[model samples]
Target: MINWHRLFGLALEDYFTGTRYAVEMEKDVARKRQVLDVVIVRGTGEALVDPCDGLEDLRPHNLLTYKSGQESLDAWAIEELIGHYVNYRKAFAPREPAARFGLYAVTTRRPRALAEQVTLTPVKPGVYRLPVVGRSITLIVLREVEPCPRNALWEIFSFEAAKVAAGAGMYQWRQDDHFPILEEIYRRYREAGIPMSYTFQDFRRDLARETLPELTPEERLRGLPPEDRLRGLPPEDLVRGLRTEGRLRGLSDEDVAQLKDLLERGTSRRQ
Candidate 1:
């Protein structure tokens, strides 16, 4: 199962490096009995250059909710987020010029019906804008977004889904091309001083733990006289070991037959 909350929170922090933003993960407002997925506030200090264009408006206070690909973000969810905004203001009431607020909803599934009802504007392929009273909320559908290595958000959001589809199993680790790509993505974040949790070390560890130990075929098992390597072993044990070694080496039927013939001849000679 996907940990949408953690993924979103970590990804946001990885993308926005430095002291420019104060990020609160799973922040709770007691009166509302609601725990926000992620809350980002712009730092009062020097402003940093926006990494992705058009995201400059995400300053002050951004209320973000992440939905897994399996989850749906409907009209009700949207209304609930608006409610969160109201609850947020009540909890942290600003003095004179209140902090600017923006809502952001991110998901991996398509929000067809929801999009129809709201004033949704396309910022990019998978990214949409829903017009609110004061500011617009950004809705990002990960499935609809184009794959760009340079786009940290896209890489982070799409990583798991892609990995599963690619069959990134331990035995098939070499076959998976995404592993390297994911490693590079993490490297970029580390370079910017934001070390993410879903790192290359974690990837390697998982692969190592899950994969069964493999053994190379014994050199004597590969050649002309199979008895040279099979001496002193019981008949059943030798046969079992040979079968396993053969399977691992992907030996053809003919090769097995040749080994069996050699074994039988050696047995007759011994008798």
Candidate 2:
């Protein structure tokens, strides 16, 4: 699986960099004699990062499981992740409340219906939650997430070596509309000295482009209103507004263009 244990550890270490918790991978559960994919423990480092968006605040401890896109997790998977939480509580956390450890399941595929007793709630577009006992288990659906530069999870799609091999067929959507963020993540991976696993070595040979071309300043300014553009304001802000706020307002591109042209002519005549 392209050394998922190493890849996730490297990525999450960076993701939670500066957080109070330390990121651990392939953690052993001596009770069940099983290994966990990842865990976050408090006091691992200095507290420096604000909480990441769409992710809950880090607790004293957290348990996580990761599945490649093709892997279909059933009720058993849920049971297993919860079991890790149970073990974590029994072993590590004592003075803390029951279920002090958080549980996380990150995958590209939508999980099958969970146990009837488990109530899944939507925390965000790509994040779901099940509060069991006194702790919370979060499900991160990678393919369901929208592209954003601010999302720390871009590493899952962009840089996870296992995904390059295991997820190509099923979770291709992970690469869609995320080229910019992906490039940033890839750069970090390279800078961090994390090597691509042998599983992906053959695949990287045929890899075409590393990143897509981002919109230039000229392109961003192209359709902006003369008043806004000539005001020497940030044209990218206008483009962002057009894409997000304007869409919400139901403003069509044609409508925006006509308004820009009208303003351009008005300003030209006055000059």
Candidate 3:
């Protein structure tokens, strides 16, 4: 079975790298094994370049509860989320204003039972604001969110094949070494019988396209073979920077004769 909770937390960690928020998974709110699914605390650093769909208005402290596709986001889940929020507040910031904290419930699907119990006001597409115990909670339905770059992380957990493909294509990891996490997600999807048309090779190509442009020419060609390094260059460009001896140094007499013949043939064809 897929460890959705842990995977989701790690994804969030990768998503928030270099941002002002710090993500902690399975946070211990009390000594009695009361653990919160995830907690995101505001810290000092660069702000998010592109915030997720339901997380536009982040507070100093945010508590999030996630329900995978296999699980139902029922009334008990919301109650537990609220209970965790209360415990966190009492223990960590009893004197802080309620406005300093935020509550979020992210689910792969809509919480029908929770919706029946309380009103979930539609704040935006796929996002709802629920009022409970005088506090507002943001409910993000991942499957309903529009497929876009900002919502790519949420789409990864949507468990729908199309959305997962879109997310895999659009989402750029903040850190360079998170490909293994993506591989695990793909493996779980396959295990669950989801037909993902987007293969791991597609992901690798997309990742290279996104990251390669930011690197210098030398940096990009660091470990490439000689032929690969000069793969796309025109003949003139291949020898443009080399001096006469530099170009001839590595050529044997037979190789030099073949090179001279090839150059003569090219010149004759052009003429």
TM-score of each: 0.55, 0.53, 0.82
> Weakest 10 consecutive residues, lDDT, candidate 3?
199-208
Judged by lDDT relative to the true structure, which candidate is superior, 1 or 3? 3
206 Cα displacement, candidate 1 (Å): 16
Candidate 2 clash pair list: none
RMSD to the native, candidate 1?
14.6
lDDT of 2 by residue, 174-253 (tens): 22343333344444445546454533333343332322245567765777788877685565755664655554476678
Displacement of residue 226 (Cα, Å) in model 1 is: 40
**lDDT by residue (tens digit), candidate 1, 51-167:** 432355675788887776557888877777787877887788544133477788877677888977777888887778887666567888766765543343554544353432222
Question: Would you give me the overall lDDT of model 1?
Answer: 0.64
lDDT of 1 at 12: 63
Ranking by TM-score: 3, 1, 2
Which wins on TM-score, candidate 1 or candidate 3? 3
In model 1, the worst 10-residue window by lDDT is: 165-174
